[model samples]
Target: MPPSTVNRQWLLERRPVGAVAAEDFRFNEADIPVPTDGEVLVRSLYFGYDASQRIWLTDDGGYMEPIRIGEPMRTMGIGQVVASRDPGYQVGDLVEGFLSWQDYVLARGDGPMPLRVLPPADHPLSWHLGVFGVGGLTAYFGITDGLQVKPGDTVVVSAATGATGSLAVQIAKALGAKRVIGTAGGEEKCRWVVEKTGCDVAIDYKTDNLDARLRELCPDGVDAYFDNVGGDMLDTMLLHMNPLGRVLICGAMSSGYCDVKMQGPSNYMRICTYQLTVRGILLFFYRDRLAEGAAQLGEWVREGRLHVEEHVVEGFEHAPALLPTMFTGKQPGKLILKVADPD
Candidate 1:
């Protein structure tokens, strides 16, 4: 980082009442600060845009404390160290962590460096922020550990066209599911899931009869349900669950956005009737096993068994506009904002 360089940041302006507004996030430009002692200054390369980012804006907050008003929005980013004062990270070491929506950041210590120097080479650099990143790891662990997909089990994934669900559906196939089913919105997403993503069937939950379609797709019963979109879709999936079924509660995008009472599942009692095992995943809980998850996903990517789709957005100027794309179904796959090219 040079003293003359200017850093642009997307700061949280105000918490939103419902859907994120352009005014909720405001942009600012500042001089790039130099790395202090025991710190590394990195140039931001990419940003990971997850649905959970919306929840992070709420007053009550989700998982972690909400991003403070008028501060740089907290996000996962891939970056390359431009200057180093830390022993752990060298100049040009590719790392991923709590990099904000800014052009440059000061990584102070190991606390900020979770996964170090491990960007994808076989695939594009964006994969490190998408498929081989947190979203991909969520699908891998949520399936392999949370759901534990078996050779002949019937597995279903909600929001199957989204980042985590899409990967989860394919991982189940790679793990040898007898039948892999997905629930996506609209014809294009449904067709893409079944035809391109290798799911046995795709239920267009927006227009189709979910109950009828699930029954047709999983004749025996749904052995595992990898849920991303919660609310009514979850309730329907629950009704068709097999005995001793596994439900990986990867995310509740709907319940997080809407009033929980209005959108909450009514068929939760099915969990008791079916003797289903339900596990919620937060990704951070499996921090110790991230390497194992990444290695396997990377291998699957190399073998062409796993395919990753990244909806890459360029420029720091577009950061505020891109944040709203996730909630509106405008983004095609995993959303990543590319800020700077690696030198």
Candidate 2:
């Protein structure tokens, strides 16, 4: 006989202060859910930690409502349906949504996290959590729709070795940027971004002087800045930007730091003087049109034009601790927590 399975989850115990800790979340097990009418029970496979999810943990949640005490931590993940009460979905269907930090999710077909079926398991489910999901699409649109990069343009992507940053570096090249520079916090990551992601120059911010390096790397001035690490990096890049430069605001690594220590950017004047265009992008805005980019990125990955990486961890127990690494820049790539495999 098969062993009994239970749904294990982490509930928010309290809001995080500096770095997220195990004390902030309480883990417990519950009976695997039975789907009601129009609901499907999806057994989660791989869940990923996004930098934005940290914003939801704070009392002042920026975009969406904050996760309250005693609520399941909101995360994006992929799962295979084990049982179903909805005609639109059936058993064995892999789905994607705001699957929480848990083993299973009972989702309605039309809920806020509407039950959308995923592509067949051609690649690892983690890829769905990457290029096929938010990371690749964010780069696709952030470049095509936001920056509109051109040949001979210099595009510098901060957090270059990250899931999104890695893709952005490659996509910038494919989109005709003659020079693509990436920034990471360490030498190992810096080397990976250049060697693996094909970035023309990789700056290790932890060791090198970023301002001095940027001045040296882009003597013509930065034509486009794809900012993922926003703090002093953003300010320094701002000072080096050429006229008509565009700054794409994908993530704010700085805003969160300031939230802890109370600080803001000192580079507004540079933006004004350079006549730069600054627009903050939200993937939610591209919801309906997401497949266009996802398909393109999927083709690129399959064609070996771009590569995607995952910083995968096994089991749900380590999730709380694993999430803090993104903030600290210790994670290697798109951080995926593998929970289970498809039946």
Candidate 3:
């Protein structure tokens, strides 16, 4: 078969404020790139659309560099190695890496997460972009290894319906958390979080009063909190923290798109009063330990102990419109875009 000829990509047009707008992204098409001596040509199959990308656009102090304006947006994708000049990889190998949001990627195999062959077909390739991927690794580290939730302890998760949060809830329960409570935006999302993640209690932050609802659901106070959406959510959750409660700070999704200035948590004093331990986790900072985390998550997936929900959108051309869906709470699970399901 002849090699592919072109690639379509979504480029960053502008930085977003408060919420990402449509004009912030632009689509570009270019000739298929030929690989150098040690590189390969990868045809993208599944690409992740995570809420964390919003934070990546900002030049904030982070583990990774921000995606420059006018450049192809950065993403983690699963692809089949259609062509390779590198000794480490061969043609027809399936791999996952930080590929572009494009139909084809000229992978140099030099990125932080260089292309690695995909797992068994029975394991589901999409998991490389979500659960069993970065999201799952993050959840595993933050909960089991970071917070150390024990059996019969109360565990609460914010952004509970989201990709990482949902997995955290499940992992917490799987580790024997006596009660797992999740907080989400709407009634539907709250229900979905509990139903899918097997959380013991679910609260709708939109409809329920934060302090009161948390008190009602967790009368004994929260023992551990897996925080994904920061801002007011953290403040409320902090107010109900039990003595010696451990909080794993995951992502700041609530403020990821806030170009406008926003207030930090108002109840931070509670952390001192309750003698709480808050740990901020950036997955990249733990890259050396990712394989260990992935192994645990993979075991859970194989045993059917972990359930992953993937909300996939189709086409690279549709990526511009789809990336903003994470902020609107429209994506039910790990948001991904099927750039090319080419046969």
TM-score of each predicted structure versus truth: 0.94, 0.93, 0.92
Candidate 2 lDDT over 126-225, as tens digits, reads 8888877778888888988888888888999988887888898999998889999998878788888888889998999889998899888888998888
Higher-scoring candidate on TM-score, 2 or 3:
2
Q: List lDDT for all candidates, in order.
A: 0.82, 0.82, 0.81
Cα error of candidate 3 at position 342, Å: 6.7
After best superposition, candidate 3 residue 57: deviation in angstroms? 2.3
Candidate 2 Cα deviation (angstroms), residue 112: 6.3
Clashing pairs in 3: none
Residue 299 CA displacement from its true place in model 1, Å? 1.3
- Report RMSD for candidate 2: 2.3
Clashes by residue pair, model 2: none
lDDT per residue as tens, model 3, 68-93 = 88878878888888789898887878
- Evaluate residue 143 in candidate 1 and report its C-alpha lDDT on the 0 to 100 scale: 91
Ranking by lDDT: 1, 2, 3
